[model samples]
Target: MDGYFPGTQSGPMDTTETFDSLVRAEFSPRTSYLNTASNGLLPARAVTALHEAALMRAEGRPLLPLHENVETCRAAYARLAGVPADRVAAGASVAAHTGLLALSLPPGAEVLTAEDDFTSVLNPFHVRGDLKVRTVPLERLAESVRPGTALVAVSAVQSADGRLADLPALREAARAHGARTYVDFSQAAGWLPVDAAQYDFTATVAYKFLLGPHGAAFLTVPEDFGGLTPVLAGWVAGEEPWDSCYGPVAELAHSARRFDLTHALFTYAGLRSSLELLEELGISAVHDHAVRLADRFRAGLATLGHEPLPAPGSATVSVPGLGVRQPELSRAGIEVADRAGNLRASFHLYNTETDVDRLLTALEA
Candidate 1:
């Protein structure tokens, strides 16, 4: 084990000069990776941590540290979300957490949603079948809230085109109508400067902008657990998991941990390091860096006589009818996504102006 792990290195590893320095230190993308909306590249630290974790499992060493990694990731995400750790529940998917939220609603309750939002956000309500699911254009979500609307469920950032929801306006609208809010932060949390505290219920997957691996998702609920029953609660949701394991859970946890599901321990081990890297970079700085890159891409597209989807301040830029070029671009070592006939390219803190220009040059060719 001693030889398997490297000696601990301290300090920022020379990150003080600029974000570019940190990016240079942590990553070495072989391509101009412009597809964070798909999945993020892991930092070197996270990859190394994961490798060591797997080796520990192979050697049958103590895995108790893996559990500790889960709690560290939970707390770090709470800080990123601007909420107390006690209110956040760690889970595996937004859809699973939405099942818990769906159970809290009475039959026939009206659920307002955005049209074409990620299915992970929409499908859960549809599965309930008894509730009324209403869809409106993304721009009309806030104004669509009305009396009898039991819940307002939508993604904070549209996954298809990267348009941002009007969060402040949406929050006010939900309050005015007595409707509760559930926001999917899958595409926004890491670099969008969002506050989970602003919404009653928020769920985010860490693999996207957060740069964690898959199999890790987070749900934040109000102090009262939003009146939702933890129908899927297992031994982990008990006040004392060890003590309650043999019985019907003598006492459930009083906090959001009541909804706790067993985490993917090895993934969590690596995610702990990923979250540490994100916290070090600071979300505000990441936001500016990503949005700046996206805008630069959009301007380049305009000069080439192609217009992108009208996403004013999003970190994702999607050019309409240009998706046919995706194959050629990929062959040239530029990574991007083509979603529903739109050429989609999302930027993150690790990307640079040079990456943006490489993609533009490829698209022009």
Candidate 2:
């Protein structure tokens, strides 16, 4: 365990490994770009662990011992999210877990959520019935909470604008109206601090901030919440799986694990490795790195005589001048996401101070 949780030394291990590999491939010119937080680049430790797991799978190991990995990953995520291990559950994606929760709600109930939510969430809510959907301005989110609302769902950070939400306030409003709150922390996981024990339920994809693969996500359910249930449960979610008396009569697991209906041991092992790596690099450090980079980017954008979206203290900050045909910026190989007439730039730990400066210089040109 000491070897696994290397604390702040995790980055050094990666740095050393990268150095050694570079020595081996010294002659090869590399096009190094940071995409760890975006596409779930596994840390060296995690990659090694997953490789071992894959080898075991190739040998046809029975039962897979995935529960151990899942439990281990759950413990790490719980510690990071400020919740008990039992309160946390791992799934293929936050979308799957939240969708199960959404399905468990009263049919055709009004679910008040943000319009800027991630596409995974938007698609699920779109096909659901009895949805009284209202797109509220970011500033009026607190004022917009209404009575009889089934659920108040919002993203901790907007995937489009990279803005952080007032989660504490959102939680308060939902509780006041007797509505359950569900937060999508996909973009905020590694870059933000959250106490899941303080909220009704929170879901985030492991791939984004947790630095895991595509099929692993996590959800934290409040210790006591009756209105929300796990609609799509599986043998794992049910207790006494090996019991003779089998059927829907099986009792669900007494914790949030009840939300996990399908199991993917391969992905679970990979996620466990990633979670271990996250434990190594303390959340506080990771958040500081991301925020510093983002602040730098924001400052640079301002110097270019353009304003970012959502403003400072707004829900998010969409980059300016993305679509403009800037000669040097385009030639310099800078790219951004354009959505709803706004450009988006994201920041994370893998990003450096230099990256922001490069972006700023290119945009200025």
Alpha-carbon local distance difference test for all models: 0.87, 0.65
lDDT of 2: 0.65
Q: After TM-score superposition, what is the CA distance of residue 1 in candidate 2 from its true location, in Å?
A: 31
Model 2 residue 150 CA deviation in Å: 2.3
RMSD of each: 5.5, 5.8
TM-score of each: 0.95, 0.82
Q: Looking at model 2, how many pairs of residues clash?
A: 2
Query: lDDT per residue, candidate 2, 1-365, as tens digits?
Result: 11111123233235433433422332121212233334545566566667877888788777447657877888888888888888887788766766766676666777777766776665566567656666776656766888988777788777767666787788788888988877887877775777777677888888877777677788888776445566666677776544513567368777777766566776777888766655655566556555656666677777777777653432124754564533334355644445555555565445555656767776665
**Which 10-residue span in candidate 2 carries the lowest summed lDDT?**
1-10
Tell me the tens digit of each residue's lDDT in model 1 across 30-144.
9989999999989999999999999999999988898889889989999999999999998999999888888889999999999999999888889989999999999999999
Q: 154, model 2: CA deviation in Å? A: 0.4
Off by over 4 Å in 2: 1-37, 242-249, 311-317, 321-341
**Segments in model 1 whose C-alpha atoms lie over 4 Å from true places:** 1-18
Where's the lowest-lDDT run of ten residues in candidate 1? 1-10
- Scored by lDDT, the top model is 1
Q: Quote the RMSD, in angstroms, for model 2.
A: 5.8
